[model samples]
Target: MLDINNILIFFSIYMNKTCKKLISCYNIFFTEQGVRHEFR
Candidate 1:
């Protein structure tokens, strides 16, 4: 049986890691777009 507390902890950790990665990716994508706009 899975413990509810353990599941919550694991989910939180997973979400934190994914959130950081997503934020970095979003930043990179926006930066690229901004640079392209400036060049045009």
Candidate 2:
């Protein structure tokens, strides 16, 4: 059970990083268009 918890935590962190990267790329694309949008 402890190992499973650790795996879940790792997956969550990995997903968070991937999501942040995607959002950053999206923000760059939107900024190029001169429109302001936020994610939070």
Candidate 3:
């Protein structure tokens, strides 16, 4: 039972890390697009 809980915790942490990276990438993309749109 303890081993199962440890595995779950590891998976959750890995997911959270990936989500943060994706959000950062999206933010950079949108910021660039917004600037171009405003100029046009």
Candidate 4:
């Protein structure tokens, strides 16, 4: 079985990567919305 500390470290790294991805996606989405709003 995996050690508890190892599992926690792995989970934190995974979450950090996913959080970066989510932030990037949100930035792109908001930029698109802003452009659309300016055109209207």
> In model 4, which runs have C-alpha deviations exceeding 4 angstroms?
none
lDDT of 1 by residue, 7-27 (tens): 999999999999999999999
lDDT of 4 by residue, 1-40 (tens): 5799899999999999999999999999999999999999
* Model 3, span 1-40: residue lDDT tens: 9999999999999999999999999999999999999999
Question: What is the per-residue lDDT of model 2 for residues 1-40, given as tens digits with 9 covering 90 to 100?
Answer: 9999999999999999999999999999978666544432
* TM-score, cand. 1: 0.79
- Can you list the residue pairs that collide in candidate 4? none
Better structure of 2 and 3 per lDDT: 3
Candidate 2 scores a C-alpha RMSD against the true structure in Å of: 6.7
User: Between which residue pairs do clashes occur in model 3?
Assistant: none
Assess candidate 1 and give its lDDT: 0.97
lDDT accuracy of residue 5 in candidate 1? 87
Pick the winner on TM-score between candidates 1 and 3.
3
Poorest 10 consecutive residues by lDDT, candidate 3 = 11-20
Location of the lowest summed lDDT over 10 successive residues in candidate 1: 1-10
Each prediction's TM-score against the native?
Answer: 0.79, 0.80, 0.85, 0.81
Worst 10 residues of 4 by lDDT: 1-10
Every candidate's lDDT: 0.97, 0.89, 0.98, 0.98
RMSD of each: 2.1, 6.7, 0.8, 2.1
